[model samples]
Target: MKTFLLNSALLALTLSLSAVGGPTASPALAAEPTPAAPVAVPTVDVDPALWVVKDADTTIYLFGTVHILKPGMGWFDEAVKTAFDKSDRLVLEMVEPGAGEAQQLFAKYGLDQNGKTLSSKMTEDEKALFTKAMEKVGLPAAAFEPFDPWAAAVTMQVMGLQKGGYDVSSGVETQLTAAAKATKKPILGVETMESQLAIFDTLSQETQVKFLVEASKVVDDMNSSMDAMVALWAKPDPDGLARVMNEGLTDPKLYSALLTNRNANWAAWINEQMKKPGTTFMAVGAGHLSGTTSVPKLLTAYGIDAERVAY
Candidate 1:
């Protein structure tokens, strides 16, 4: 079977990068415990997208987010703010753990203690590609010696972007989370940290390495690809965003794990959230809201009346 680039998909689709810090770890994903350095507030404003699902008593606002961005986007205002301000609670893909806890969790599943190296799973050709990628991100070959392929893939993909100046602190969810905390509004997550890790861990080793190789191939294009995706997102063009993000999603289990099944679960969760009387602001990665397997598309099957909120 052919492999697709799932590393970018993991960043684009799941927004699952956690605190995997070390001198060698990707800066954007490393150091989750540390408070983010203050961002240079951008004067250039942008209108990303959002949707509204409602009935007489319950209203849920669904927004798509980019998990990392270059440090100059002014996104958390206009319609996005109105919806969030009116919301009773904020729902995210997952609530991240703090400090050593997130690092411990990532290492627990992503590392090999018995000294099985990540490159040992690859062919000579694949190893050559992976080695070059590690070097491109300014990490040594031995830095990933203990990495599982998925972990290496995660590190390489995000590190490539971070090296290009994308900061996790500048991501959509990061700022929203900070604001939500300041206001003391309740925040909830659709998945747990352990469960998100298991999605990658349970993949067949072959699949994991396949994606790792995919990461190696695309690491050079990371900035350009993300620039295009973010451009589409700023236009609030879900179709264009879908076209870019969902491209090369050929691996069946990866497609299911990263988008389809998770989206279905989210739709089901949104449907259930409608049972009680309250407003919810549901924010997830743009990939989850823009595709055919998007939460809005699935919500339609459940007879949940979801409409584009014209801002």
Candidate 2:
């Protein structure tokens, strides 16, 4: 359940929320911005895991990323940068929508116009838990009344991240997308933003409410888990990352919808890309590139092997 954002690609929504406005998009995160870190911090060289799939002419680099981070993470230097610089094209999980479009999409799918308020979906105990967490973040009990459960859940997580000083502008995708645009590199998406939103929109109400309840339990301090996840990623230990991110992701149906199915789709996409002749750097959430149902493992079933790129 916790892996939904880590593995299911809902992390993109956090960035989308920021793009539409700022963290203040949710009243929970309406605090003054923290001062930027000093410019002369020591660089901590991190070798995040990278892999490659190559044939005679085509080379595809598969790099895993933490969606958001505190600024000053010196991860873009080493082999990760070299692979990105050498690539002719950049492929991301989805090409994010612009601010106006994202705002419209959220209104269309994230709002609960036809249903009772998100709090109504909760049991008395559940509502108590969620309301308590909301109060902790200085949000009124009805602050999330207009949102669907999925939206409420995502907003809680995003607001927590903002409060913890995780900058969306420092996110790996944001950085890479800007660089790709600057160099005139053709940026592509394996899926569309609409399709990604549809995944959450199509979820069963039970699952949506369940996800919301889980999110509320730790809403005020969401970064503790992420800090641990980033530490593992900075160590370049994909196996360790899998252990942390994939933990408690046990529901079979949600598991398939979140991880295995998307990985299979990405493998098929890569197989088709192999038919062409160009270097492509594919960056996605680290959770997707780790775990037993990782993209590389699925690629193997398609007879394409992804080897680790030694730094």
Candidate 3:
């Protein structure tokens, strides 16, 4: 049963990454000729996906973002650049975690100095697995000693992705933020950093332990899962991605808290943004755009139209 739980964790985490998002509808938009390159970069032909919500004056491009990717994957093509270039502002789930922002936040919520250490909370077999997993990713055992289970889970998720060849520099969020900065456009966050972090921080300890245990199991098999994610995203298969993510998570409460609730909140925000007049580009995790509880669906429920752009 212990080994079974350990193995099940990887599949759940994989699903979690691909677990947010809604369906697609379309009107064709003409693609202008792509401009000359600023510098020579390796190119890969993959079209992820994008959606647009517009009224008379306001046009917001909704994009799904993979937080990490292997270096040299060329996803910033003409269609994406066109939408991004036309937008006046860039919106993300949270502001960029630069200048020790993450560390400061972790110090406040992640530390469990008065409570049991992470190892003490784990079973003997689980502790061994956790230590081995950390070491495999070059994280010292002591590094996670003070962390809450949720924090440890999140940390391990990143480490697993990194070990699988996904580079943070190549992630959609990083690229878009850099472009927004270089172009001097304002960057807005849909939610505060604190609110985003609090999603996990506020979870019950049993749930947090479940999350952490599952995360520990993914170290060896994350690559295959990531590959499936990239393929689904590259195909821009919102419906397929939704099915993979929404069905994989067995716990309704966790799914609701992590993906469903957030999508509804974002949909509500989008409805408000539509009332104002401006072209804003909003990029969030792809999973939030699919399934029945996705942002697009929620927006549709509110009688707002979110059209997928045909590339």
For lDDT, the strongest prediction is 2
The residue-by-residue lDDT of candidate 3 on 21-73, one tens digit each, is 10010000011122233344677788888899888899999998777777777
Across 1-311, the per-residue lDDT of candidate 2 in tens digits comes to 45227422355664555544433235432332444663554657778899999999999999998777777788887788899999999999888766667667766677775857877788999999988876665556676777788877776676567667676667788899999999999999998767777777878889888877877876644787878788889888999988876664655666777778888999999999999999999998888899889999889887999999998
How does model 1 score by TM-score?
0.88
Give the local distance difference test score of model 1: 0.76
Better of 1 and 3 by lDDT: 1
| Candidate 3 Cα errors over 4 Å, as ranges | 1-41
lDDT of 1 by residue, 158-270 (tens): 65676677777688878888999999999898987767777888898888888788878877787788788888888879998888766756678888987898899999999
Which candidate gets the maximum TM-score versus the true structure?
A: 2
lDDT of 3 at 100: 46
Query: Could you tell which candidate, 1 or 2, scores higher by lDDT?
Result: 2
Model 3 lowest lDDT segment of ten: 21-30
C-alpha lDDT (0 to 100) for residue 255 of candidate 2: 70
Ten-residue region with minimum lDDT total, candidate 1: 1-10
Query: What's the CA RMSD for each of the models?
Result: 4.1, 2.8, 11.1
Q: Using alpha carbons, what is the TM-score of model 3?
A: 0.83
Give lDDT: candidate 3, residue 293: 85
Give all candidates' CA lDDT scores: 0.76, 0.76, 0.68
